[model samples]
Target: MRAIMGLDPVGAITRSVEAFLVALLMVFAVACEQAKLPNLLLISLDTVRADHCSAYGYGRSTTPVLEALSAEGIVCDAAYSVSPITAPSHATLFTGLMPQTHGLRVNGERLSDFGLTLAERLTAAGYQTAGVAGSFVLNRTFGLDRGFEFWDDYFPAEGSKHPSSEWMGHEVPAGFDRRADQTTEIAADFLRDSRDPDRPFFLFVHYFEPHGPYVPPDRWRKDFPCDQGSSELESMVSAYDAGLAFTDDEVGRLLKVLDEMGSTEDTIVIVTADHGEGLMTHGAMAHGQHLYDEAVRIPLMFRWPNRLAEGRKLAPAVSLADLAPTILELLGINEGAQEMDGRSFAPWLLSPSVEGVTFPVFMFRGKVRRAVVEKRWIEGERFGVLDGQWKFLTSESEEDELFDLEADPKERMNLASSYPQEVERLELLLNPWVRMKSPTDGSGITLSLEERQILEALGYGF
Candidate 1:
């Protein structure tokens, strides 16, 4: 028994064995942490409104598929988008910041890529990432393509010109099945081709249907009539419902694919919308003009079998910003990746109680705005702070309005006259919202002479 020191061979062996055991324990702990990360799938519907879905209690059967998904998970009732526009709203969802903070204020503008997106954080954590966006607004030109390993932003050929069609309530171009079809195809391929050793994927598929022109397949068209069954406007609503029906079926197809692949139990599926379409709510035909309830409210649902309880509804004034952090939390990713503005709703998913936590979801729109609901009020130009019913809106005009959401859900009456003191309190919170918006002097990428002429003919890019 030769030992370097005056020790027997057995004592040396014993020390070595103890050291080896300690090393093995450390490796096991690291592997356990890495294995905890869950796969994520985020789905964004272009124009489906929250009120139009059965999960949100709409009169029409616009979302049977979405209803099924919600029945298996949690549905958010008081969900609202941070902005009304498509690009800015989506940016807010990914970055967990307001449109003003991210700088994707309008359709043509874009957020800078210096900050980490939800996809980027997942990618850093060793997850594969993909984005298949339906609208040109989601194109890389707008920077929504950052952080994704593969981004297929292909619009219909004719739709290349109609960036504002969301306002007109129309899908891109006369014939652009490529938007929805290609997104599905590419996303599915990404799922199939991804290798096993890599962490699972964070796939985002955005659909551009039921947005405008409300055209549905022949089978779905006849199901609903205009006006509960009366006006062209009502008929248009019917058509919108039909389009939603088609989208729901597509969602079902995706879910079925997941089930077939044995991925349903392992994936965290999220479904939400950029904003809702107005069937003439507050005298508005579509989104992008006013911050009426129709344009601000959106549907948000999440499902993850064995991860979250089923058949639950959460109320905490949730916004699109909360989606990113909530998903990250559920995925068990704690790389301290980046600071996100939204907090994780993971606690509520496992347990329905958000009672003590008090963070009002604040939404902003237009140059100046007003408040909705009682005691809680908001005020700002491009920014708002909701203090628990009187709301104030900031602009050059600096106007304030108060509503009792409990008493006046429709917001038909303004009670600023009775509650003068509450208005002042909300004004203090509104200051930061306005101050956070960085002013931009940058213009859209200039067009060449020929391109300018073409854009003018197509009613775009002027």
Candidate 2:
């Protein structure tokens, strides 16, 4: 009877049930995959320049750990910070917005409460978020600790004394900053014993090393010993490199903790710098005074084994502002990216070919104090745009300057006069950005006296 009808009702029903079961299984598999969130470890190395890192081709082995990680990760060869100042650059890093939009223009300036940080978004998505800051500049009072469940910014009280050997004979004020090793120890403890092992976590570790008052441990100083006749700048540079190496060792220790936890392969490890030090580049002793490449270009690297391409180097110019959006995209989070000023570079990471990929990197430098101006560190506020090979810099108080970065990477020669049309084109791109009003208002926050003193110690006083 079933053969006569060419289909039996019982068999047809069974086939349909099997098909539904297969569809349900596929859906469940996808759901399980989506539920598995990878842990995130974000390490910010304060004041380390890209060109000074061994991974970026610096002659010295300043960052052997970074070089080893780069071997199994993707390196962004031309990453820049939107602002050269610590607070502003970190604000951009967390918010995926430019300093102008985030409303943290300089050090000591608070990040607006209105903006959503990367940590906040990740927390909402069910990830455990924690942060350990190396400097008082990122204290909770400054508003960078909004989304973190546990924020560690504890420094000793003022007037606390430390042995001269620890600080390399410099009188470092207590409650100002902590060393990279200390920060790494805190971060490793959180990774090992504090966080919920079952739940994915977002860990942020900041290392304030190689900044000003270059102080390296005795061993590192010996490793980078300066000649007896070395100039002051040379001595400073040697100390700076030693500090970098010390920070790198701490980074290695942090990574070792992750490996011991058996989460190294499953975690997304990102290493970058808040901004670069001046090191007398362009006649500036430290950062926050110029828009030169040495001050703005940062080291950005992403390491995710088996998930991302390995040992690849991207040549396109990317901003620190792009970090938040890129991380969210990589983790399959799509809710709050529309409001960011930075575009995601996730596609470039996934795509095999990155040819002809270029984007404009905008930078801003607010006016320094009159005292700094009198010293001629920098004159007034400066704005710069780097698009393709041409970099255009303009200031209200200084002359307009342009450079073909490919031809003159040092930016010694100004071609603003020769390339009027290029400057005009870049101006069209920069003017509207400069004029855009910030959505978040941080002007209401006033710095406390202690905070002001800390800023002064960090070389950021009005």
- Leading candidate by lDDT: 2
- State the lDDT of candidate 2 residue by residue for 261-343, as single tens digits: 89998899999999898887787778887788999999999999888889999889998988998999989899887778787
Candidate 1 residues 1-462, lDDT tens each? 356557788877899999999999999999986686667889999876787888788887878888889999988877878777688889888888666556777676667864579888888888888888876667776789889998877565653324444432333433233445555666777777753534787889898877776667678887875545467787887888887887787878777778877788888899999988767766556776545567777899989887688888887667787777777777777743236556677777777665445455566674424544233343444444443443444454434566666677666786777877766656545544554434342443344565445423422221
lDDT of each: 0.70, 0.84
- True lDDT of residue 340, candidate 1: 59
TM-score for candidate 1:
0.80
| TM of each candidate vs. truth | 0.80, 0.87
lDDT of 2: 0.84
Who wins the TM-score comparison? 2
| Clashing pairs in model 2, backbone N/Cα/C closer than 3 A | none
